[model samples]
Target: MAWDYKVIDGSEEKTDLGFRDEPALNHKRTRILDACKRRDIDDLQALAISRGGFLTDAIRCQAWPILLGVHVDQRGEQDGISDSWTTLKKHRDEGQVKLDVNRSFVYYPNDDTQAQLDEKKSQLSDLITEVLRRQPYLCYFQGYHDICQVFLLVLPPATRAAAVARLSALRIRDFMLPSLNPSVAQLRLIPDILRAADPTLYAHVSRTEPFFALPDTLTMFAHNVRRYSDIARLFDALLAREQAFTLYVFAQIVLRRRDELFLQDEPDMLHFTLSKLPQDLDLDALIVNTAALFERFPPESLRSWRSVSSSSTLKTVRDVSACAAQTLEDGHRFFEKHHRELIWAQRRDKVLRTAWANRALILAVVVGAGAVYFRKAPIWSNLAWSVPDHYF
Candidate 1:
């Protein structure tokens, strides 16, 4: 099947497509800022829908929370750390979070120093921990830290927590479920979306396990995209629109890469192509295509997966809160069943930390003494150990 790929000229801001030119974008920014200043939800939503998204990061920092339905009044107020954070209980998922955090350098800019990188990683862990602790029911999946780091970069700590909490409870709730069942159900929508948008591409992808969309969906494209700026641009549209809009975006990405993907008849090859996104992707064109796809196949028209509802119908913050309440109740039942196991895990972690500390101390002492003894030993005797036999 032949597809018409849109070639967007970055120099030419305006296109026959819905993309706004510089002057138009600047006008939209003015209107968006006005709407934000007034806390006008309806107007803000209107601008977001019509203009694609907020034009700048400073604007996004304000508009995103509003779009997510975060309380505007709470913007600058520091809620301090959640009480749950104070207790600092070791979560069953902490180990997984640690592993993911160690690799979160992808989110940092290349120019960032080691100290800055370390601080961001540490803060990323703390933010995720606080959110999970406050709502102990939300499961911490592998790519969650990637999603949270986006918020960490944009908002202040307290506001970042609020925004992430709102998102977890509402926008990407399925991904945070106790199991991957809800997330996989969400993943299934990608092909369904594709079938509606581009049937040939859909058929090609359907041949493979749809779980290939997992990393992009779970991480909100934080894992897939290389540039922070690009991901942020994508999120500007994402945050502005309905939660399920991501499905359309994912479909658009697959459709965009159809040429590269079609050659891979095998599922493994398809998975490899889908997993690593091109570094030089035209995000603006992708966003335009995503919006177009969503327009063609609105959520209501799409097939509903088990337990997952249409995102269009689930637009309001109230809807998200209600869903969160139910999820929390289910989580409480889960906690009750596994209470003892969690407690045991926490104790085991403490013991492991102590043992590790002791080993480090012993290693330090051994290394110090070995160094001292080696310094006093004859240089001639040390040569045998230092030099290769061939060299000798």
Candidate 2:
């Protein structure tokens, strides 16, 4: 039920800017790629944890899919390349997806030209839509786009959908479920992680709403961390380790800000402070602390904190593999029984929704709503909303 923790020792060397030097980083990159070539998962994972992460974008493109357990051939197969775009046409979440896409320009750096930002946003929308179409059973949460944006930037377009699909089905599986119940279950692990890492800080935060950890969990730190580059580095390390390791990283973030959080006694103030991450956070140190925390209190010890039989816990690659297989089987059964009716209904609903959205857009434009139209559209109603039972 728990993972075997491998402790990484020795101090890491870094430059004045807090990054490892080029030669040392290149060495880590080489080892990671070599491990991938040999399909040596243990070595890749060890390097990821010990070295902190992959060194460059080039290295992540090659290493990330391997870490996510995605196969080269499986990309097109899982995405169903033949009809993916067609299926996307019928996605009930399309309206909400566009709203989220419009807000995703923040993923780009402020200095970039509007043209570059627009291109990236368009690519992001396409990639997310493709992934959703392939895995129609997975619900699209509001912050899910933040996580997908990372892949769109790092991985090649050809591999992005498959990589994101595997990631959603594996490490982030619980969050993509039909309801928020599983996500809440995952967030509950934060306190348990904090209790193991730093008991005093754990007690202080336990008194507040644990929902402060929600954004970090849902967005994979993409929402919290301002810099895209920093988020990529953090994700490089996260993707390399077991899925549950993110709990430790988040706990480390809390402990890093314990001085500020400790001063706030009110739940509202504590939540507010925790929600907005500091811009100047030293990511390298946080990653080091996260790895150290994992070594100190592995998943085995945390499982004892589970209060209910249905509670979700940290899953290993093997466990995830089994779960993915079962999920695929269930999808096949569901398709066999209801594919015809579901496809027809989805198509009909898509037509109605698209017409409604078009008419609303036209009305807003005629009324001179301008930017307000995009921001105040009824798509916001989808916030905190789930699909109807029939759709599920």
lDDT measured at residue 300 in model 2 versus the true structure, 0 to 100: 62
Candidate 1 deviant stretches above 4 angstroms: 1-25, 49-52, 72-75, 78-84, 304-392
State, as a TM-score between 0 and 1, how close model 1 is to the true structure: 0.70
TM-scores of the candidates are 0.70, 0.72
Looking at model 2, residue 180 earns an lDDT score of 69
Error of 2 at 220 (Å): 0.5
lDDT of 1 by residue, 1-392 (tens): 11112212111122222443556656677899998887676676556545345655577778877766565444465333334464856667888888998999674455677887898889988888877777766688888888888788767654788778767766666566554655666677888888887888888888787887888877888887776566766787777666677777888888888888889999888888887767877776777778788788876676754335323123322232233234333434434444444455569989989878799787899999998888778984686578887885
* Top candidate when judged by TM-score against the true structure: 2
Evaluate model 1: give its lDDT.
Answer: 0.68
Q: Give the distance in Å from residue 198's predicted Cα in candidate 1 to where it truly belongs.
A: 2.5
Model 2 worst lDDT run, 10 consecutive residues: 1-10
Clashing pairs in 1: none
Residue-level lDDT for 213 in candidate 1: 80
Q: Candidate 1: lDDT of 293?
A: 85
